[model samples]
Target: MSATEIPEPQVWLDERGRPCPLPVIAMAKAAKSAHGSPVIAVLADDPGARYDIPAWCRMIGATYLGEISVPDDKGGSAYVVQISESAQTDASKSIG
Candidate 1:
């Protein structure tokens, strides 16, 4: 989704500077407390995140809505995921 189209009070994660897998881990962690199919925005400069987030969604059954633009100061692109409302009642409780 576009910047204006992003969900209100969305979970915005700053996973920049983290190593491989950390960004995905952080995204999954935030999703664990989520309700509805809220969109999550992860600001990550790690190149792996571009590939990892979508892979995580495929494995976790969430929707990978692709990346969106952020302000120059954000220092990273925002990758969004739509937590499937039916995926879990307590969000993603497992790491697998």
Candidate 2:
């Protein structure tokens, strides 16, 4: 999707300095808590995020809206995600 088409993040999860899978987990938690299809921005500096975030999004059926540069001394990157409505429903579904 085009950058202009992506909506601004409704929730920002700062996972900078955190390790690979942790950021992904944080994103999952954020998506689980949020309602509807909200845009979420995850700030992370770990190199793994470049691959992991998009992979996680795809695995969860969420839309990976691409990464944006974050202007800060830390020089962290902002990975954007569009949480699909089905994602929340799937998360709420109980395992049998």
Candidate 3:
């Protein structure tokens, strides 16, 4: 598959319409869609994500690979975050 078609989960936050938690929620949905263990990337326009994404990663026990800033032609920025496998699953869960 092509790089764009790699099947990685991607969440797009509404840049002009939503607020802080919405971006975080979007990231969560993308992570959840990974079926408990896959690296998902989230694209958000909210400044909150710079901190929120990493914080969420911590709460979910996922690895926050970090964020990249992509500038749009129109003069805005898009933040892409790489969520690691550890962040996707509840590794703390124990076998019964």
lDDT tens string, model 1, 2-93? 65665543778888888768888888778877776777888898888889899888887888887777645858778888888655543455
Candidate 2, residues 11-82, lDDT tens digits: the string is 988999898888988888888889889999999989999999999877778889997767477877999999
How much does candidate 3 score in TM-score?
A: 0.58
Error of 1 at 18 (Å): 1.2
Candidate 2 collision pairs: none
lDDT comparison, 2 vs 3, better candidate: 2
The lDDT of model 3 is: 0.56
TM-score of each: 0.79, 0.86, 0.58
Per-residue lDDT, model 2, residue 59, is 74
TM-score of 2: 0.86
Which numbered prediction scores highest in lDDT against the true structure? 2
> How many steric clashes between backbone atoms does each model show?
0, 0, 1
